[model samples]
Target: MPAQPDLRSSEPQRGGLSATQQALDAQTALLPYALAVFTVSLPAYVWAGSHAPNAVWMSATFAIFAAAWAAFYGAVNWLKKPEAATDLKMRGRVQIFCALIWALAVGQIAFFADGAGAAREPLLLTAVAAAVVVIFFASPWLPSLLIVGPAAAAGPLIALFAQPETRELASLSWGAIALSMALALIFNRVLRRQFEMAAERETLIADRAGMVEAARRLAQSKSDLVATLSHEIRNGLTGVAHVLAAAAGRNGRGAPSREQLSAALDAANDLISVLNTTLDSETAEAGRLSVEARPFDAVNLLRDLVLLNRPNATAKGLELALHVSDDLASAKTGAALADAHRARQILANLIGNAVKFTVRGRVEARIEQTLSGRIAIEIADTGPGLAAEEMERAFEPFLRVERTSAGTSGAGLGLSLSRQLARLMGGDLTAHSAVGVGSCFRLELPYDPEATAEREVVQAEVSTTPDPADRKALRVLIAEDDGLNAAMLRAVLEQLGHHVVHAVDGRRAFELAKAIEFDLIMIDGRMPNMDGPQTIAAIRALTGHGGQPPIIAVIGGDAEEAMDCTAAGADAVLRKPVSVGAVARAVADAISAGRSEPENRVVA
Candidate 1:
């Protein structure tokens, strides 16, 4: 039976290939050289034997040589296999065995030829030629040369040394063997060096290709980002500007109806969401994303998102429903300690995605508490689901699964950012889907039983909605760069019965604050002459009572901008695309916080 190849010879070397493996490759590449030599030499030996005096012995030697060559050929073919070729030790053994067989065939001719004087020169020359050929064949693996080199020369050297008259021929053969072995070692080094250089060149080429592909992908990503943002922002702003123009009677039209305003609000909110998601993704990539964790009713938040997304679902002719687990509903508390705003954001994204993708079937939002005290929300949709590969790619930033006809609208950041926000709050977001069935996205958050119990009691005592009329109207000062934004702020504040004073920039606002005692100061983060933080710092530096009013920073950038405002001693921060309720809440919170911590200041 053929010997099985050694499967556990050694570990792989650099580039995931071993020296033995490389040598095997060289051996396979050089096999044709051996075959060519054998093809020519066997016929030449047969023709030479026809004229020799001891033609019988010559015929026997030729038979031995031919048989040895045939056996070597078979072994070389077997070694061409993937498993057998890499075994350096096995190939070395085969080399020694084949060399011994050829040595024996040559020794028969050297020892038993008829005329010693006539054969001495030719026999010595034959030994030298065999040694050279063996050296060439064994050069791929150095260990094989150690035995094959000596074996090829041993027979001729012994036969010549046995005759007293031909000691000189033996010395000549010995010198030839020594030179051939030395040259074999050098040739082996050259062969290995050439192989290494080729491997390195291939590796460098591969690396260059990889880098080029990565750069191309990056450029494509940038282009896609620019195109998506341009389309979404233009559409959103067009809706908002049209609504505002109609409401202000700029087109000589009556006041816009409630539904038109709501549509505009939705467009503006969608635009804000895209911007916020992009910022959040960047912050998360920088490892600086944070969450403001507090106790809130997660079930109620989910229900609110369902209601918020119902319009979109209805427009798509899809049924949207919310399901609460029996345990959670009976307990009357599905509270969680996390960033409530972030929770709302994540649910809104999931629900929005479900509604957008589902063509005609239903979208369901299910909330339940697990036995391990974790809250899980599942957003399942009867949409054309994603395959395994697509599902995996769905959470990659800037990637969108657009297998449906619902045109890709908005930046592809919803799932990626939602997952980041989920994990930041000690939770995770995952999905399960089949290609034609549907998709279900699960969002899990760490649950606090104590928070749930506390939330139930608090919910019973405190109303989630606050009345703006219950508080005393404030003298508010607004520092805004845009005239339209300033007008909107003034209108919202005045409707809540607050006296409004508007300044075009931070410098003018600062002058007004020094002249009059305002109840609250609302400052936009970016303005000419002075930014939000600079103005806040300058105001807080005042020695008189002018800087004592509650100051709110209206940030339109990222969390870093809010941090800057906080560091500059702002009482509170209000993000842009703000609503009337948000403004009123910010005002009330700033006043309450100012009264509680009048000397609170963060050094910048």
Candidate 2:
């Protein structure tokens, strides 16, 4: 059994609940202490009232004690009860409101003590007062306390000074407050420093964790790359070696019949298929993928993909089916130019995996839009299904599971790379599987808002295969800045049977176009002086050269980048390092289409 993955995850939100809950619990635990402060101070008010000489003074004293009792416990219970837990902003606001109340309660006791006929004993409230002093001295909000406590005390303290008879003997009280204020200030300064240190520590810890995650992800990508390379090289070389070895063994023993040669050829062809697929995957992963977004029918692409996969499924004796929503069909039929190449790659991975795995039952693919506004593709395979363990592991690199009676062949990089490719195209791939119920993989792509067709034309003096009557007898001009690439194309094109000409850049290609009549013009997308598109646009503007050569663009970067190539004037684009056959075919098609009257011939 493969190792199980822990799926519970943490959110990257600020002031997360863990920290807030901790602070709340600490505040709550101090509730009993707050309650005790007012409770103890009750007796202090009673005694002071009894010692009062007049009814007014005695009543004043009584109200002071009651106020102390109510205020202190009110603060306690407020802190104890849970506030708006989900609202961090509200918690902050509550902190300020409660702090203000604390200031008011403390101020009343300080300023009105002598006015309310003086408490005879002040001992009851001493412990809590001292405790509060100790806690607030080093509290994170100590600096703020200096302003609040003093601000609240200032108003009534001024009035108290005017009323000499009531406040004249409160010398000790004034001195104590002045001293507490001084102590609070010192404590606050120290707390500010500590808070700074703690904050720095937290930031350092977070940075460290971020670095660790980055490292882990890099390691995973590297391993994935290695696994992909391993699968490609090992599979290709192994197949090729076996074919050669079998052929050699047969010849050494006895001359093999027609059957052996055919089998050997078939095996060799399989290796070529693997090599092509692997190269495509590598090119994509290496960020060398080229795609042309022309309004092609999505229905057509889907049709081709289904037809290609159906035979494989049939051979596996697994039912294959497809259902494309009408909306999806509408979106596809010459409505948008998407990275249809990438879409095909994604489908290939899905169907390849499906056919590989299922021995009986069925593998199905469905493409439609969800109510949430997304293109959803679901590929489900009914094989032995996936165990809970294997389900998570299935998408991981090189993570092949033990087959149940019958299952897929090869390493498990297909799904992993496929999913990565999906995400790169602004989509997601997800899987659902149970032990005995098979697996369903879903891919969703945000619909492309702009589904414009690539209307640019690619014409070049393309080389043709060895055929006398239809050999490429036309002159083709090649424009490029790179000496080596120019030389290579000259050789490659001449060998392909097309007469080849050369130009260093746009100016040169333009001059050549004017000076000579060429059947096709090959343009490099990125040229120093005048780019292929600019040169082509210039050539089209010219009055001479009544016959416009077809233009084929050779591009190095993402061909799907519409801004670069579409506006660059490419008739039809081919990715960099153009193969002889593809170049020939593109050229044949362009010329056969007709090199008409100085039409737009451009390449970027």
| Per-candidate count of clashing residue pairs (backbone under 3 Å) | 0, 15
Candidate 2, backbone clash total: 15
State residue 62's C-alpha deviation in candidate 1, in Å: 5.6
Task: Report the C-alpha displacement of residue 350, candidate 2, in angstroms.
Answer: 1.3
Which regions of candidate 1 are displaced past 4 Å?
1-27, 38-68, 75-131, 138-197, 222-255, 274-343, 355-363, 367-376, 381-439, 444-466, 474-572, 594-604
TM-score (all chains, Cα) for each model: 0.65, 0.63
User: Scored by Cα lDDT, where does model 1 land?
Assistant: 0.74
Give me candidate 2's TM-score against the actual structure.
0.63
Cα miss at 274, model 2 (Å)? 7.9
